[model samples]
Target: MTAPTTPAAEALPHQGPAAGTTPLIIRVHGTPAGQGRVSFFGKGRAVHSNHKKLMPWRAAITDAARRELAYAFPADAARLVDGQPVPILLGAIAAEITVTVPKPKSAPKRLTSWPITRTSHDIDHHARAVLDALTHAQVWKDDAQVVEMTIRKVYPGEGIDALDRPGALIRIWPIPTEAVGR
Candidate 1:
């Protein structure tokens, strides 16, 4: 059987050196539920905040996670006055799946046409809530709305930091609304 072609590889954003480009001190957390801490490399950096970790779900449900991880946090954040450092996220890690990719193989003695698999995509999305949480004090309110906002703002596939397995699939959870009984 034939194979599919990959889209043109996109270059990472070139924002110049981190020296003046507004770097954030991001901390990460992985526990009963993955948690993240954002702070500067140094300077006793920290913010008193709490963000939730989403559960891995099915395809349809993935949408809400994107919205929440990408949009909600930014929306819920407190308004920043000025000069206060904006948060910069590294990424999150939680549950994961592994996808293997094919590669040419080379042996210590010789090379062979036989196909060998190399590299794997570490599945992740729930971790995004942390990245999405970073923003000016005012912007990230620590709420689902902020996550939703972030999802809407970032281009698809780009919102989740580069941490998922290459062939990893994603799951989305639906946004909860009021019950019909009221």
Candidate 2:
């Protein structure tokens, strides 16, 4: 089957104590997949494999991130090292991610306001997949730079209108150096 089409990523102006900075926002379209357990194989050296669905999800996240980064910082788009695009954000980073899944058709019509408790995967697993992809996309130097993160999973209408279908919304900010210790 063909991969689902995702909307273009956006860089939204942040309005707060930090006025000039804009947060990188990415909307990934399609059913969000969790990072599956790594399976080990081979007798001598030991090999490992990831979940079948994880690669596609990660690719989607990476592509979206790259597109947004280039659009947000056009000057940086030309800066490449070893034929790879350099990461845009550095130092401590903050991320907020919302994964939205489709509302099941079998659900009772009366159960509209309740949280999704019967998801196929845990919230953290979904976070892992996205984070890893962001790292691969060179959105930041490394996932370790993410000092603050808020991630959640919800169904369609429970989240924003952009995510009315199954997908994820990722927002990333670079935390000021002064905010590290305190």
TM-score against truth, every candidate = 0.21, 0.79
Report the error of model 1 at residue 42, Å. 45
**Which runs of model 1 end up more than 4 angstroms from their true locations?**
1-12, 15-19, 30-124, 135-182
Evaluate all candidate structures by whole-model CA lDDT and list the values in order: 0.27, 0.75
lDDT of 1 at 154: 16
For 19-133, candidate 2 gives per-residue lDDT tens digits of 4667789988876788866655656553214456677778888888888888888899669999987888888788889888667677665555433564547788888899999
Q: Which ten residues in a row have the lowest lDDT in candidate 1?
A: 147-156
Residue 49 lDDT, candidate 1, scale 0-100: 27
